[model samples]
Target: AQSVTQPDIHITVSEGASLELRCNYSYGATPYLFWYVQSPGQGLQLLLKYFSGDTLVQGIKGFEAEFKRSQSSFNLRKPSVHWSDAAEYFCAFFTGGGNKLTFGTGTQLKVEL
Candidate 1:
């Protein structure tokens, strides 16, 4: 079984501040994890992915994540968040039992000046 958990339902960060979103996952094998961002009432966009290789992965919009196998975590980070970065972020992974992706509930980001 593979599952993702984003404990934070909502988060607020000041503009230009560094941000980190928590994610935890569980699986039977080496998991392939992914991060996606979506605007309100929109589809998800891939942020980054961790298939196999170096634990750290980078993606668009200056986002990055580090996969920690021992802790079963893949937390997303940004050096400095912008106002436009405010959106619903999701953590997902393809299940071994099924080909489709199972996503976490999601974490909505709010940028405040």
Candidate 2:
């Protein structure tokens, strides 16, 4: 089975500042990784994904993530965060058998002025 762990339960960053959210996964082989963001009262939105190819993957909202097989990590990064970027971020792994996803506990991002 595959699982995801987000060390930081909550994070705070100033507007226009850089941000990084850590995510670690456990799996036997290379697994499908994904980053999703959910605003208050909104559904989960796909931020980025990594299945193969490049180690660095870019997603919407100026977000990017690097898949490091050695570290078993796929951390999300943003050069400059916007106020609207404040939301709950989730790291997930696709099982690929039944279209199921195992998600992390989530990290709540608070944007300060």
Cα TM-score per model: 0.95, 0.96
Best by the lDDT measure: 2
lDDT of 2 by residue, 1-113 (tens): 57899999999999999999999999888889999999999999999999999999999999999999999999999999999999999999987673899999999999999
Instruction: Report RMSD (Å) for each prediction in the order shown.
Output: 1.1, 1.1
What's the true lDDT of residue 25 in model 2?
96
lDDT of candidate 1 over 65-89, digit per residue (tens): 9999899999999999999999999
Q: Give stretches of model 2 more than 4 Å off.
A: 96-98
Pairs of colliding residues, candidate 1: none
State the lDDT at 92 in candidate 2.
94
Q: What lDDT does candidate 1 reach at residue 50?
A: 90
